[model samples]
Target: MASSLTKDSATPAPEKTFLGHPIGLATLFMTEMWERFSYYGMRALLVLYLVSGGADAATGSQGGGLGYTAAISTAIYSVYVALVYLMAMPGGWFGDRVWGARKTVAIAGSVIMVGHVALALPGQISFFVGLLLVAAGSGLLKANISTMVGHLYKGVDDPRRDSGFTLFYIGINVGAFAAPLVIGTIGETVNWHIGFLLAAVGMGIGLLVFLLAGRTLDPKSSQVPNPLTPAERKAVIVKGLAVAAVVAVFYTAVTMAGMFTIKWALYPITIAGLIIPVAVLVRIKRDKDLTPGEQGKMSAYIWFFVAAAVFWMIYDQGGSTLSLFGDKNSERSLFGWEVPTVIFQSLNPLFVVALAPIFATVWVLLARRNREPSTIVKFSVALAIVGASFFVFAIPLSQTAGNDTKVTMWWLVLIFLMHTVAELCLSPVGLSVTTKMAPQKYSSQMMGVWFLAVTAGDCITGLLGLAEVKMNGVGVILFQAAAAALAGLAIYMYRKKVDALVEGTK
Candidate 1:
């Protein structure tokens, strides 16, 4: 039987225990929130740490940093951030084929904790190695955790599903919202290594809580719905190990040969980023099990994915160039206290925390009234808004600041708010739709497919930030704006057709 209901449907209707969702929701919520705290905490400090100089702090010298040029620092940031999402492919595969989501999340969480701890140690070797560990761990954990959240729900059309994910996303922002204020301040004001340690402690707490809430999930919650035979498993493992070994050796050779530039890493990442997600969509559309309707939905999803990549490419600058601007050019006075530059990183997540509930409610009310924006419509709006944000910043480019000009804080504030609203319109909705439209057999893998766009976006965002070392910030912002506006316009023009394909879900 081609069951339209999800794998979890046979279980009893879940009792409402946490905010009108199941008790397990709370566990995943808390785990994800704290995990994000660690991730974003580290992220808020990463680029700043890289570009900082040493042996002085009184004159606002970014001393004690890695002391790299902005270009190289952002390049490194781009690659690390790209891999964080790119690795989700193999991580999701492992969960679906072998370890199951539970073990994958547990193992990945531990690895990330260790990575943060390593980052706290003083040395260049520790820094790179710690980044590698954290990237790999995040790959293994992120998509799978979102997959597990989907596992807790049983219906494709459950009214509460989007809201549930919305709540889960709110938890993510709570962590994100706090990370800049806590770890970012610590890294920026106190000591960089101490900030890293704070991140590690946050992850450790999340892991402990996850372990303690062991029974919150259904006994089989983490299992692969389509388990492989022993022969199949053995073949997959052998192939995976061989690939891993080859990649490790190739990168080692490149680094040793002094050929491992960001461009070297980026070229393949860009290629694979396109290949992976396009291939996933192709496979999904061609799946024998999908009804014609499902195939239509899959097409709509491809459009949404592309739209999201556009949104993220522009949005990610909030962490990179925007953060740099805050550190160097933006006026940081809030209530007459000079805010630490790291505080700017909090704006997106802070807005997300404030905006998500309203968006969630808005979606439901519109759905009930048959006035809901089609997902494509929401995506187009996101694109236009993201573009406008850059345009907004672009307008103030020459505003009388000679390496000392604090452009009105309102400029950055408005930009962050626009980006956040775009993200609210796009991100959680994307996560929900990935769960809804994905084939049951490849559930977690689809989440990975979605993140591949993020991987590409991060890479591109880095390149854009890197260009600021050579290019003017105003020109860069204008480029971003034009690109997003074009993409949004294209999608908006074809939205009626898109709406038809996405007929089943809002």
Candidate 2:
């Protein structure tokens, strides 16, 4: 059956790159690069815009935000990030069972472009509409693009698999590296809307590229589920998009209802939404066809979900907690030139680009020696490092007291370096684990479930930030550090069992 699709079958060889790697691989990389650029560029500004208050000469507004307190803004930002990932479940479902990856990506790209354009418009109406489209579009793009990348490999064991993914990961960082500087500069120097407009333009480039070369996906691999029947596909898409729209409306209502303004409503609504999915996951555990090994892996995956949520709560600090810390606590002058805080956000991705190649060689060398740490072991290290980075922040807090004197900027540099290294251990590997452990039928939805942790983490991280404002600053850093360390400890304690579950894979 596999040979039927391939042009060469003598040795039963798999797909080959037009150069040295699969052609499809490059297409997905560029498409995702622009998509990530749009997402991260917006992220670079989100918290700052929210907290700094978007007021500027062109915006012609004072206190440039929705007038929410810091905590409320963080919570909103967290939930928005979470929902973008969570929605991917349905987005993947649409791609796998309805549109196929190609069409799904195109539609998603176009919609996201529209969303960015809407964000360029003024007023709450535009803001809400733009966010809704962004969430929906991201859902459509996120999982499908990864799925398409998997299509480039003929089998799970392909040697180029990890390298291809690593290359693809590089593309993501490339976009991330460029975004904050490009959009941040425009938004900070000229207008916030212009920054959003730049994101829309980036998405446009991605859309054009994907549309032009989309046929690289033809004779589509079995990895992609067959397209739905015409009638069935149409019905599912219409129904799915409608359901997504409804979900967006609900999310907007719950998230925008500021905590202080309506704490009672937001709390219950958020809890209910979170609990429902967890309950569904629990029900899946009882399915009879799943091997015990599979069940065990899924259970471990849940813990991973928890770990990732915790990880992001700390890791995503680049945009929120870290950004604020830099703004107020650190000395930002580089040779007497003060740079925008947003530019500082670009540091992690820059470090990633510089270090990922070195790390990839290290992993391969370790794997060859049969000494590569188990996925859970790597995750433990990741969490531990992430937790430890907070101590860097604590140094500034302890030393900066009683004076207007600034802490050395290297403290921020050192912290981001540690965070980036830990991410090399956790984030990409975590996503890879989801693709590996998930049952074939549930791949995309499960990936979405994995991202749900991110959403949850974002919410919790905001709570942590709120606590920082109210509690002792050094104490806050210590607490976050403790949380990350505890997460690593939990995984370390379960290492034996978790290792057994993910063995021979992940």
The whole-model lDDT of each prediction reads 0.80, 0.76
Instruction: Determine which window of 10 residues in candidate 1 has minimal summed lDDT.
Output: 54-63
Model 1 compared with the native: what TM-score?
A: 0.86
True lDDT of residue 440, candidate 1: 67
Q: What is the per-residue lDDT of model 1 for residues 1-506, given as tens digits with 9 covering 90 to 100?
A: 44746555776875657888768889989989989999999999998888788321113745787877666666677768888988988888778777888888999999999999999998887988899899999899886887777777777577777778878988988999899899989888889999999999999989988889968875565687557899998888799899999989999999999988656655666566556666777877789998787778777888888888888777876776676666666676889998887888888887777777788788889889999987777888889999998888876566733445567777888888998898888887787788787766666467777887887777776665445452225766688799999999999999889888878676
* lDDT, residue 260, model 2: 30
Local distance difference test, candidate 1:
0.80
Model 2 spans > 4 angstroms off: 1-19, 54-67, 153-161, 219-269, 398-405, 439-444, 462-472, 501-506
RMSD of each: 6.7, 6.0
**Clashing residue pairs, backbone N/CA/C < 3 A, model 2:** 17-21, 53-64, 54-64, 55-64, 82-455
Stretches > 4 Å off in candidate 1: 1-22, 54-59, 150-166, 222-224, 255-267, 283-295, 365-369, 400-403, 439-444, 463-472
